[model samples]
Target: MSTYKLRQGRTMKSPLVNLAVRRLAIALVTLLIVAFAIFFATQMLPGDVAEILLGQAATPEAVAGLRQAMHLDQPAFLRFIYWLGNLFTGDLGTSYVNNMPIAELIGGRLMNSLKLAGVTALISVPIALTLGITAAIMRGTFYDRLVSILTISVISVPEFMVATMAVIVFAVYLGWLPALSMANEVTSITGLLKAFAMPVITLSFVISAQMIRMTRAAVIETLDTPYIEMALLKGASRSRMVIRHALPNALGPIVNAVALSLSYLLGGVIIVETIFNYPGIAKLMLDAVATRDLPLIQACAMIFCLAYLLLITIADLVAIVSNPRLR
Candidate 1:
């Protein structure tokens, strides 16, 4: 028995490790592609960093000086290689807008985005899971129908619209929540939560909505499987039959959806972040684009891409590991 168990463990371990390595390799290659695209595309844009700096007032001499300073005169291929090399050496350079290092500018705002994402994940995941379970267990009943209708509505609504409506309702009409503010002034988590209420709700709505439908489907599907029917026939309580039997199998879909939910939550939440004027990477990227801040834009883009990839990868691995069928 011990030897058999060991062999089984080895089999699982080997496949899992190989899968992780393959995913990691794919992700690394993907990162390179993304980086190259960002570098070349930004370089190929009509306006140079100097134009961004001097605005419409730039002259031949000023543009030349600025271009020289920014090394924009370099050949495109050299510029690409230089950009990639600098990235490897931890050099993101200074923002043309503020003259501050891109990293420093991003550092402050990144924290805010992280906090918002964290709060969102903490709130939405459980709510979504719970609602999903309820819908699944109550399949064919009014409860299931009601949740399905609501989730579809929520999912269909764009996050920006939700953000706008939430602000109007909560901030304008109710006067219960603040609109468009998460400045450096939030000194405590309590204050942060209060300020973040509407944004959080808006961010979580679609995500939780997606979760609801997926969860319902996953659970319902699992319940219909023959093994679950057998468990039910054994006189398992409703809760036990669902939780112990159906939920494990159902969780695969739920996990996959949750992972995608988080992936979309990355740069995809830019709309919500923009509506709220939340100074996360989304807003940061927006600002960079408006000002044509090359370094800042590239840095922000890379950060967002890497974050999205990492979140999706982690979610995929978690989903795979948590599901017996996949394992």
Candidate 2:
């Protein structure tokens, strides 16, 4: 009997493991496709790297020599092959403009971006989740209506617009925070606040608004299920019913909502970082574009894509594992 039960447990676990493996494989394939697309897209950008680097006074012969030296004289396909091969070996190559190794150049910038994203997430998640759950618990009340209206309003505005307003209100008019974030100058607690303040606020407002809406939807959907209703009918307090019965079952959807909303940061941070002049990977990529630095651009693009894929893959795994049927 014990052996039969052990066999049954293994049988139930195998499908989930298989699904996880499949998901990982799909993510890898998707990443490859995305990398291919990113590589070719950058290749199509107008302007020659050799010309851009050499300036207008450069002779044709000089440009040809520079191209040859940089291996830009090679066919696009061969260059792409070489780039992709290096990518698998963790070699991001050197920047055309900076003439520095891409990894070394972007290391601090990537950390800055991560810091911004992390602080924004830390501030936004709990507030958004609390508001979402509260709004779900108070559905149809004036408070619920108010929360809904506010979240929708915030969501309707673009991040750049939001960032602009934040700069104006906080920096230009009030003069409370700096117009631009000087991340390198941070030293004391106050300096840290001054550095991260405006960017974090801009990012948080946008991220939280989306999270609140989705979290509310997920919770409310769970609340309407039959089991929750039955729990309430059996004298379980509404709060208790939701906290105990509804929330646990709603975990899958809630996690998915969080993941989807956070994914917005990948795109939104670009605008935020640019607006505030924050020293981050997005800003690095933008500068790289102006100089037609393909290696740097490709690396930044892949980092964003890989991060997005990771978030989505983790969310999928959580949802799969949380499913009662799968259990």
Candidate 3:
């Protein structure tokens, strides 16, 4: 009997392991497709790297020499092969303008973006969840209506517009926080909070709105189930019924929503970062594009794509674990 039980355990575990491997393989294929798309898209952009580097007055001979030196004269297919090889070896290539290593340029910028995303998520998720759960609990009440109206309103506004208004209200008019976040300003924890204040708020408000709506919907659906109704009749208080019965069942969708929101927060901070002059990956990519730095652009875009893919895979795994039918 013990041997049979051990066999059953292994049987169940093996499928999960196999599923994870399959998902990883799919993610790798998706990344390869995305890398190819990025490479070609940048290659198609209407400017010459050689001309950008040498200025408009450069002679054709000089431009030809520069393109040759930069390996831009190679056929697109051959260049892609070379780039892919370097990518596997962690060589993201050098910048066209400054000639700096791509990895060195993005290293600090990537960390800055991660820090911003982390702080925004830390501040946003709990509050959004709480508000959503509360709105669910108080459905049809004035409070619930208020929360719904507010979240909907925020959702209707664009991030850049919200960011502009936040700056006007908080930094320009009130002068309570700095208008622009500077690296040196974030020396201490308090300083970090203050520096991150505007950008974080700008990002969190937009992100949390979606979370609130999704959470409310999921919780409300769970509350309507027969199990919750029976629990209520069995002397379960509202809080007790929600905590013990409804929440557990509602968790699958909530986890999926959180994961989706987190992924958005990671990649969707571009407008917010641009508006506030935050020195994050988004800003780095924007500057790279302005200068037609193809290698750096490719690296930045590839990083974002990979991050988004990983987040989605994690969400899928979490959803499957929360509701085993997905397996």
Candidate 4:
């Protein structure tokens, strides 16, 4: 029985499993570093949180008392350690400005951001993958050139510019959609469509451009392999050869591309949310910054960093698992 148990443990120790474990460990370490950086960065920002909260007319004694009550008087390193420990227990600390639990304040805003991101991803992913695959299959044709030129043009434009253009075209010129996305006003399908229209359009365009480019590259790379060439020479149809022979082999890179492209939403959504007056975490973070709300700012920054790390880590694991050589 002991021998069987030992053999079972050995069998479980595959390279892919080892790689995933290592990747997760790395992500945890990266999160910790990011947390430290965020805490300290917020600390370095101008003006004291207590001062900001108390306002200009407050007495020095009141400011000092407020500082001590909020533990602002604590040593920076000690405060960071305390904050990090609380984070382990899911205590995000109270907002210095709002005097509310950071978690409570962020909950709804975070959900809003997630909903926006989910909608954008749902619309963008299928379109990107289909266009990318089709472009790769039709390489050197007019369709391929058209996709290449369009993607390059879109990619060259920043998200803010895209969002601005979307607002101008849809909201100002056409008057087809609202420039602002009011999350709470959506009660019916029409309301939902109106609320999501401009932001989704902007995010979709930016994210789809990147995904298309990367997906096309990955598929094209896979199609150039000797086995793919041999499969084509065996009288396989272009579509069949690509769908059956290339895509499966290229799954690792394609998944990585999708993940990396989606991760752009993290950065891009900040601009999208801000421009459209969307009630999301990014906008909340901006508000927190203006008020010098250290806890809220740190929480929002950590969330973004954590999400970005999680996506990259997942992509790495998928790449490792999907590689035939690794298997």
* TM agreement with the true structure for every prediction: 0.91, 0.97, 0.92, 0.95
Q: What lDDT tens digits, residue by residue, belong to model 4 across residues 1-327?
A: 999989876765587898999999999998999998999998999987777788899999999999899898999999999999999999999987778999999999999999999999999999999999899989999999999999999999999999989988999999999989998888999999999988999999999999999999999999889999899789998878977889999998999999999899999999999999999999999999988888899999989998899889988998888888766
List model 2 lDDT by residue over 50-88, tens digit each.
998999999999999999999989998899899999999
How large an RMSD does model 1 have?
2.3
Tell me which of candidates 1 and 4 scores higher on lDDT.
4
Candidate 3 residue 190 C-alpha distance from true site, Å: 4.6
Which segments of candidate 3 are over 4 A away from where they belong?
A: 188-190, 233-236, 324-327
* Superposition TM-score, candidate 3 onto the true structure: 0.92
Candidate number with the higher lDDT (1 or 2): 2
Give me candidate 1's TM-score against the actual structure: 0.91
Judge candidate 1 against the unseen true structure and give its global Cα lDDT, from 0 to 1.
0.83
Off by over 4 Å in 4: 1-13
Which residue pairs in model 2 clash with each other? none
Q: Give me the overall lDDT of model 4.
A: 0.92
RMSD of 4: 2.5
